[model samples]
Target: MAMFRIFLGAVFAAIAIYTIITGTSHGWNLVPVFFGDMAAMNWPGQFNFDFFTFLLLSGLWLAWRHHFTPAGLLLGIIGVFGGMLFLSAYLLVASIRAKGDIAEIMLGRARASAIGKQ
Candidate 1:
């Protein structure tokens, strides 16, 4: 758990720093470039599509973890758009909140508690 927390922390920091640098240089207009790459159908486009799928999966999982409540749905959208910047921070907080319980981290509090009761 300690190691997991450290890993999440490192991911959050690294991605955050990288994002800042990239955004500063690129002017933060990522949508066109991202979608344009996909339209181009090249290696960068292929990679972007793959990464987009992963982000979509991440968003769906987050929504499912929260049982798709309004807040969960909102978080799902944010997860897709915010990408690792949102996810790393979210996982770090969830890990602490779950007290290192992997099941709780994945399943959320209510679901994890219900599973335990069974």
Candidate 2:
């Protein structure tokens, strides 16, 4: 599990680097596209909303794990400005913190049940 997390972290880090270079070169015009591009609105708008929902869910999960202040705020920043690159990286680190405990990795300590999937 640790090895897998490390691998994911490395991959996400690489993706983040690529995104940085590409987005910088392209000026990262998400604001205009998100607000004014009506002709190209359908897919982009839906994707944006869905991705934002994931970001909120990720933040909520982090807060549930007792990282309310910093983690939740950082999740929003990274989600809105950085994208999946940071979230994947965050999840990788979180998996390492779980320390080979699949249950802990899959379900946060506060939510993991001792009995079954009930």
Candidate 3:
């Protein structure tokens, strides 16, 4: 799972870089073309990328630090699977920020299993 996450993150980062670079070349309204309405058009509001990115990364971080359960798991899964072909760069940063929480959780589980054997 971790390996998968890392790979996905790398891919996402690439896309984000591409977007940052090419995004302005095309009309800002051109919208990205990808699987999940990658280029969907919408009126900018609080829901724009600036806000969305912050919320998503923050949520991912929180999800990792704490037990986000069904919803968090769903978000991670969606991010890993659904997000790969789209804006990967943003997800990459999010995954990087999330690494510590993920590591801590995995370590805790490892210790639990190890102690349980004794």
TM-score of each: 0.97, 0.64, 0.30
Candidate 2 residues lying further than 4 Å off, grouped into runs, are 35-40, 67-82, 106-118
Candidate 3 per-residue lDDT over residues 91-117, each given as its tens digit: 444456646354433333444356568
lDDT of each: 0.95, 0.67, 0.52
Q: Ranking under lDDT, best-scoring first?
A: 1, 2, 3
Error of 1 at 53 (Å): 0.4
Cα miss at 18, model 2 (Å)? Answer: 2.9
Candidate 3 minimal-lDDT segment of 10 residues: 30-39
> What lDDT tens digits, residue by residue, belong to model 2 across residues 45-103?
77777776776676666555554567656665555555567667766766777776777
Clashes of 1: 0
**Stretches > 4 Å off in candidate 3:** 31-118
Model 1, 75: alpha-carbon shift in Å? 0.6
Query: Global lDDT for candidate 1?
Result: 0.95
TM-score of 2: 0.64
1 or 2, greater by lDDT = 1
Off by over 4 Å in 1: none
In candidate 3, clashing pairs total 6
